[model samples]
Target: MDLSIINQIRSAFENLPDYRKPGNNLKYAVEDAALSAFAVFFTQSPSFLDYQQRMQKLHNRNNAQSIFGVHQIPSTSQIGNLLDPIAPETLFPVLAEMGDRLYTQGYLEPFISIGDTLLVALDGTDSFSSEKISCPCCTQQTLKNGPTLYRHTLVTPVIVAPGQSRVLPLPPEFVRVQDGVDKQDCELAAAKRWLTTWGAHYAPRGITVLGDDLYCHQPFCEAVRAQHMDFLLVCKPDSHALLYEWVTDFERTGEVQTIEKSRWNGKQRMTERYRYLNQVPLRNSDDALMVNWCEVTILNAKQQVVYRNAWASSHTLDEHNVVEIVAAGRARWKIENENNNVLKNHGYHFEHNFAHGKQHLSNFLATLNLLAFLAHTSLEWLDEAYHAVQTAAPSRRTFFENLRTLLQFIPFDHWQHLMQFMLYGENLLPRKT
Candidate 1:
């Protein structure tokens, strides 16, 4: 609602622990370096700070200082050097704050579904990869021939709902080699870390974690329940032998439950079959965890099977709630389509290597990029002015392109003025005397 959101983020950067000793090169504070990097991501322009710096020299003021609270604009290299050592977790508080603001403003009501539970989709993605350029934090793999592959991967968790386009992401966990650990990091390990760290914080939101078949194992499901959360993870028959074996046995006696519903597809009627089995063993062990299994199959007007899928859930499957549970499980794809795809392919340039520092630069920049996305999402959710302008624009890329072009030529004294000028072409500059 207010530009104080920007200030709050600036404060988080300002409070970062400065590893550099006192010297003349301290012309720019750590906050300036961090905020400067964020401004580039926020504007979706690589030379945003360069343009602002030129504006500062010509007009004696720049949007970087006025809107983002940057005192001195730092060079791109300086930004990388300054932020490399700072842990990405330093910005986790800002992410939590963003979610709280949205919730407090009553914007999070639509995200709540499946009987008071918020669906959180978990998935991993590579942020940086290079066969030659490598860092100590990089995870490596040997190829078939000779060359090794080095990459940085992180687990992304976002709040999603069925038929919802918007997704709110939580702080990511990097999959990398730890100090005392011997084995290479993995998605499941990073996911377990994320659960251990933030699960309690989000537990009050009534979260139901969702993931692919990789997370349907016994240990991970137990971890989810241990945090007082629920899960509806994709379970494949091939990977889950014992579970499906039990399911096959249940089918012999017709112990499995089935419900078929008919709905018109605007052209003709179609049938959707829901099959479920409760209290099924998840694995072959004697102490295996028991979970509910459900499947959904859709047939077209010609009675041809068009789609089918199954899942394992912590909640019991029943005739009344099975449909809702299946829908929530299907929404997990939003993380891949709406969040990850948008960030990587859309304007965010998520996979683009902005900076690859020796220590933590790649992941740190990724975090700042995520925060920029969160900032824009918050503005769209809360600020009517921003929403109107963005909606009026032809596309997201065109919207940022207009902003960058205007900022290169015009200097606004306030963020609201920029939005107003873009919306109605109202010149808010002070009158000449």
Candidate 2:
């Protein structure tokens, strides 16, 4: 049972329900259309299949067949038409399978932080928007002085760690209209659904959920606690008046404690001050949830404050581990910088409308795009050759550019051959099955 990654993904697509009538346009399999769309996102080349089709005509060989096992490349419109009716949930099993492989291989060990706990950050980002293009699933909002804008958004959760560049993404929950619900979908509701769907699976692994101040309220925090999971959410002074009032009272009694450390940044010394209080009521009520509060302030040698923020945590804060807890809380930003920003700015073209079918085309294509990113991240952790070449290149865009250029001119037997050629200018050996 030597199943390669590509083969495993192919099997997942093979099980997609076919919506077409029997004996109608049987030239392309559903797997072919789905994998064809995936190939474009994988190689970061929109015309990837077109180049392969040309190569198949000229040289009787194409990387689509050899590498991706795409026998017959479908047109872009054909790909959209084939995938429009298919729900995005069908592809989730593939993500789970890949993540399982990574965990089994012990590649996910570095992602654990705060003593045997994994940090999962949650946030929402708009996927597509237009004043003209619209779908039944698109949530629309009317401007005060302009036309109504319809857009698609998703609540994305990713596994993050302090000082780690890579963040492993979990399956996203799309924010759209629900049957029998009069109001439009919201991020908080979608987040709760996501937790309910994935909580049991991840709870046993000792997980802590992280989010912005918007998620610091009782209903959502209680939802997280209901799943037997922990949380470390940003808490602002203005928003959490009751909690700050308790802290102010603690300060009056001198119960609050402070710890400061100095570090040299090759030019000057900087100061990091930490202040914390344990077991404070989060709101003004008898049944309010009690949580630990911590804040970090950075100062320069001139006693000038540089940055400051605070958070509420389910885990008790102490003098020994307050710094680590604060660092873990700060790592929440990686969900924005490392994951969302790279997806949008670094060659993924996340907001670009690749296919906006009337039904599920936009979301399905977006899922494929995200899956491509997850697959690449897995390779970075598991494949030595991939990591080597990726490090050898100047940037991420440059690495993909090299791959597309080589794939355009050369016909390789498989992914290993392509990688070896890129590394050594020749196929050194066959990939182990």
Candidate 3:
């Protein structure tokens, strides 16, 4: 991890307006509290601060202060108290700035296609939920027993590509009850807010938003067009009666095009059939947007279709690029598998309730976790020292295990020292500075 990045993050938190009573002088620094919270996620350990605070007592130094730039360690309750009032939106700039750096360094180029258009997959996942615990921001729904269950859902937009395993994410939008709105909040509403607020961040660079059938409708597509961006959304036939009716009608006219090929998948011969239609009306209305639709099916030797999907695209569908478009569309799974699954099942503990303050603590903690994940991803991909450690580790779990182990037992003056210890397979001492 870059020290400069942590410095910038600390600065961002420090610069956030305290919003506390001007007459009151807080004992703990707000930025330090925030950084301590981030350190919890960064280390993937809720007890990270307790252990580091012990180290500070014994050695007069702590990993949280040294590695993440925390000047004062705050209790978990204090961390939530200091961060509750600051909206998660305050952290969006950090995500954007980090992405700009990644792009400038050409780390994001592999995700580019269709003339600088990066594929941004959008989806919602549950961040936290409890049947008994609830906050003002939590979305409430009556359960089968007539008891209300409160939950938080987050809409994540990530930069992804078909062949790439690594995915980079933008700041997520939380789906929750707002101050002035009486309507029941939902993921689509959060997504709309995400696109309107952050869409400009991506439009200048070219973006093609990817989502499921929930976003394939006319209004959402119009929203994408309004931002001067494009969309490649999953279009399920069951939901689009008129659109499929048009396709069925076009089938009678022999206007639908198809391509077939056979390939070996090591175990069986797979036959892929791709079908496409260009300039099809998205709805039956006279003013329907003319979208390009493509569908693909993969059949096994048993002649059973093993995989099937369709996408409605803003780009023109043609023989030359339809396969590429479909491949990119299929990559939407990375948002679920590579991003959400990692956060939940890996080490980040997305569903765990680290904090649930009265106001913004839940969302703020989630954003901090995302920022830490982003930092680690950048290190994994862009830092040579980190890459050396990654190459030597047996798996991602083991890599983070080694990091946490070192942070607990050892002290290093530089991040690369830990990398060197792992890479060289030797017991090492902290470098003399």
Candidate 4:
């Protein structure tokens, strides 16, 4: 564990007012719970309770005092209870600021690319859903037998690029249907809400939001445009009948630019065909939304078609940037394959049964997990100690395995102490020999 990183995080926490004061008095002052929760994430722990116990044992064994000013460690139940009453306003903004810090500090550049075009992929994911457990913020639905069920939240991350291993998670807005709203909230609705909330923050950076076909709708496009942002939304033939009809007509006339190419990778040969429509109307209205559309078809050495996809974007069309735009649009899958999949199926066990409290616990835990992932990713990208370990290990799994084994036996005074031990030998004191 690196004390510098821990100090950075502690400073961020200290910036927020102590909830125990007169107005919002901090009933709990155990910052160790927050710190341990983050640490346990990287250890692949199943829950925060496990993290708390591990931290306590480590501290007691090492006779460790406070890492910073945070001396006390609360029980897992107290941590959950403390988090339950926390307002979203108090916690989420700090997380968002962390993302911004990572960006400004250059720790996030590897994951977030800035080139001729900046692409941001957005998608909503459910953090928790249950039939038995219920909370005030949970979205409820009636069962066929008339019993009610509840869901926790749908989080949307403003991902920078696809296939890039790292993702800077934005502060998510939880979606819960109102009591008398009489509407079922979906991903698109949540996306719209996200746009309204955090869209302005990224506007100066000029991002091109990428989404699936569901986001190609008229209203969604309008929302993106209203935010002064661009979009590259998937355009499926089944859904965009009118738009496809126009494309078909244009292709028949040979008016669209079509490029056919082929390549060989060792024993495998691949062929691709690309088509582009520089300017096409998204809808059939008098003031139609004009967009640039492109498609790519790929065939393997066997001449078997391997992949095919199409997309539309609000960006103005240019012959030079068409392929780049299409590539960025295609990279949207990375959010699912890299970020979401890694969190869910990888050692993180993102879907594991963590405590589900009455208030913001679930979301808070999820956010902490994401922050941990971000921290790990940052170390992999930036920290020399992490890089050395990764190079020495057989694979990422092996590296983490060694890390977990080390954590079980060693008691770290701070995160930096752990990192120092990993980089140099455990006997190498911070002071000179």
Q: How well does model 4 score by local distance difference test? A: 0.70
Preferred candidate (lDDT higher): 2 or 3: 2
Residue 188 in model 1: shift from native, Å? Answer: 0.2
| CA deviation > 4 Å runs, candidate 4 | 1-4, 15-30, 46-70, 105-115, 141-149, 178-180, 424-433
Q: Please, what are the lDDT tens digits per residue for candidate 4 over residues 1-433?
A: 3445556667665554434547673545646556555556757754433444466675664312333334555566776765565555455666666567666786555554334345778777767778888777778778899878787666556566645655666766677765677787767888888888878887776777889998998899999989988888999989888788889889899978877778887878788878898678887777878887888888897778889999988876556666666678788888787777887777777766578887667777877777677666656656777667667777777777766766665656655666667656533335457
Give each model's whole-structure lDDT.
0.90, 0.89, 0.87, 0.70
Candidate 2 per-residue C-alpha lDDT over 1-433 given as tens digits, one digit per residue, 9 for 90 to 100: 0127788889898898889998788778889999889989999999899999999999999998888889899888888888999988888778877887887788888888875789999999988999999999899989888899999899889999998999888889899998999989989889999999889888888899999999998889999999999999999999999999999999999999899999998877899999999999888888899999999999888989999999999998899989999999999999999999988999888889998999999999899988998989988877778887888888888889999999998998889877887677423345456
lDDT of 3 by residue, 1-433 (tens): 5666777787788887687787686888888888898888988888888888888888898778777878889888888888999888999899878888898889888999754699999999998999988888899889998888899999999999988999999988999987788998999889999989988877898999999999898989999999999999999999878888888889899999999989999999999999999888888798999999999999999999999999999999888888889998999999999999999999999889987888888888899989988988887776777776676778989988888888887766666555677666633334446
Listed in order, each prediction's TM-score against the native is 0.96, 0.96, 0.96, 0.86
Indicate the worst ten consecutive residues by lDDT in candidate 4.
61-70
Stretches of candidate 1 exceeding 4 Å from the true structure:
425-433
TM-score of 3: 0.96
Clashes of each: 0, 0, 0, 13
Give every collision pair in model 3.
none
Q: Indicate whether candidate 3 or candidate 4 has the larger TM-score.
A: 3
* Candidate 2 clash pair list: none
Ranking by lDDT: 1, 2, 3, 4
